[model samples]
Target chain A: MESKNDELLEISNLETLDNYLSNMDNSKSNSYISKIPEVCKEYPCCLGIDEAGRGPVLGPMVYGISFCPVNEGSLLVELNCEDSKVLNEKKRDDIFVDICKHSNKIGWAVEVISPNKICNSMLGRSKYSLNQVSMDSAIGLIKAAINGGVKIEHIFVDTVGPADKYQAYLKNLFPKYKITVENKADSKYPIVSAASICAKVVRDHALQTWKCKEGHEYTFKEFGSGYPADPVTKKFLADNVDVVFGFPQLVRFSWSTASNILKDEAYHVEWEDIENEAPSPISNSTITSFFKMTNQKSEKPLNTFFSDRYLSRKVDL
Target chain B: MAIHIQSGKNDIQTNPKFSNNIHSMPFKIHADCDAQISKYFLQTPIEKEILSASFRGHPLLGKEIQIPAGYRGVVLHETMKPATEKEDRKFYVIHTFDKFKYWNWEKAPSKNDPLVQAMDWIDIAEALHSPVVEE
Candidate 1:
């Protein structure tokens, strides 16, 4: 009953975001993708894995894998599982179950890299760590599959991060399998399209779940699809970020978002307070402390969605 | 002679992962390896060429590639929605970015980020061409 009420509120309250975007115009650039031939030699059982939302402002990076026997993958091909971007969400949602049904195997591994941790990396070479998380999850998924005894001769992944990084990651991770990580592997391969569907659906659910549990009270607010240049999302940040301790547990402080939130100020002041520079990982107790903070502040008791053991690390010395 | 080392058009699959254990550089698999498989795998070479070239010369390549914005463009059959020429064909074969790069009518993204290190890549393999259907 509560879930039903929350969904209704989200739909009704965020009604201003009614503008429809053509999925085609919004598709990943072609330069990021390519095609591969059906290596029938790797048949009997072949697996393809990919990820989505690695660059988004909100939500966990979701990794998905789709598998089918090369001999009996007629169901997958018949569904026209070309690419997830080519199909509407309704169509994707509808066929998702069917694809997994025909899949020789399917799996989703999601890791929510928090905004604070992301904040540290943002100061470094890149702003997003979802790519790193994606690489990790992809490696974990393949390792899981190999352990599960499914024979995958060829592995396809939509490319992520620097091309060089992808190459290094794959070589070091799966030296035995012919893992091809190109952009638009979805457009070029049905297997990847299937992987995209699994990733997309799962991540969308993760976002909606976070939204439902948090409600409209505070700790986090509207990110307006979590894309940069979203006016409403930007406004939400300006409206809420004045508190001294800083942004919500979910807000990625490493994004231009944190700096932009402090745009009114010179930014150096904000940095001094939030600069969490330490070679050591934040103990899980810090995560718990954050949860307690939110729960204490909110009108309702907050549920901890992630780990709690992030404290007791002797204060980052 | 080295068994007259059979080359080109070999229908076979040898592990590229462990090439040192198998064939040497420019190695030959059974006549039906990637060469033959690649050709048939591609439904239309013209379309694949267009996509390959566009990807190689990406429009979003900020300062890395200096392409002029006014350059002409073309599209591939798959990238476009309709098989016929009437639909929205946004696939531009050649285009420039920030009024700089001329997209040399040829080259692939792989070439720009050349594989000099020869490390493993995240290679996603899709069947390049759809299976031929009789009209």
Candidate 2:
């Protein structure tokens, strides 16, 4: 019932983004790519990469890539694409909608890295830093674009850490293309601005439509901006501290803001080591008897056999 | 107050319920939290028998344990609360299980675990109580 352009217009709409996100498990990272622009497939195109929500303690971080014909760089400026941080949410949404209208010239993709995935990668036994996660997302997006048949020749990226190191790393990975990693590429380059808008719009919509996997019904307004500095976010973190689970999956548990709150408020959970530690000089019996003296009224002394296995008898279900 | 376990008349015999894919987290949560377990708590087979899953952010290793022959596990549900102090609270046997996976935080579930050691006691108790034959 709808024309191709009309369908493409829905790409920036709230309902469509919500539908796409709701269908997938938000606990894991997900990727979405636009249909390759017909012109982009035939002509040599310049691609740009940027991200949004990187520092947020809540919601997903989005890595976005936008590509257009090499000569159409000015067209992005004409569409009012600019640094997403400077533009308000409404202005970014408008520019994204305008970009969608010219779908024949530009194509874009976004990788939505969920909060749970971020926390898992950072806090897991083998620590994976946030910078590594960002780099992987950027690399993944570029690969997705190239694989989708966008004949990209030049690539621009908004840097995560040291720009020179990131530029060298990307250059090493993608030897064929001209890659530029700059501090404020979103402000300097129109293509990077377009990418920033795409990423920002997707991230904003993700926060708006977020359904807590842990089944806590919370409005987005309740936790403002997802920044550790925001008072609302701090209050939300403080108010929702669970004795055992700490916080819901909506939070990035690896964030010092959330972890600090848990350290102060939540119950202490001790994880035993896989490899046995050397026994204490005081002896196990001495410690057991000491605990028995203090816990005489509340608990029965566990047998030596059961204690060796770290078993405690349950009095109730 | 006393508690009474009620065995209801629903006699549908199903396979032993095993939490094969669930992560047995170390800590317990008191709040009534619900989740789409199948969607979120996915387990990957790390080796031939060892399984791995993520809980919160921590990695969990797990393995299935079968109850010794002739032993069964039951899952009970509380059905009613007593109206008066004189009456007892009631719980019903909702289902039964024979084998369930046990998980350890970042450690493999093995014979050294408390649950596994507890199960070992069943065999020991049986051997100890059995009649001895004099040669």
What is the TM-score of each predicted model, taking all chains together? 0.45, 0.72
Q: Write the per-residue lDDT of candidate 1 for residues A1-317, one digit (tens) a residue.
A: 22323223221111211111011111111101111223322455566777766666544455777666656556578877768777887777666656534323333222333333344344432343546655766777767666655667778888886666686678777787776777778888787887787667655544544532222343223555455566766766676553332344345555666556654532222112233366667556655576453534444422321112121222223
Residue-by-residue lDDT tens digits, candidate 2, B1-135: 567766675763536333343334655544434444654555768897898766656667888777688877666777566779777677787666667778776678887777778876778878998789888
Q: Each candidate's lDDT (Cα)?
A: 0.45, 0.81
CAPRI grade of model 2 = incorrect
Candidate 1 lDDT tens digits, B1-135: 011122233423333332211211111122222222221111112343323111100111111231223321221123335566444434322211222121221233234332211111211112334465789
Clash count, predicted structure 1: 46
Best by DockQ: 2
- Listed per candidate, the RMSD to the true structure in angstroms reads 33.7, 8.3
Residues A219-296 of candidate 2 have per-residue lDDT tens digits of 889988898899999899889876666777788888888888877887665665545687768634655676464644
Fraction of true contacts kept, per model? 0.00, 0.29
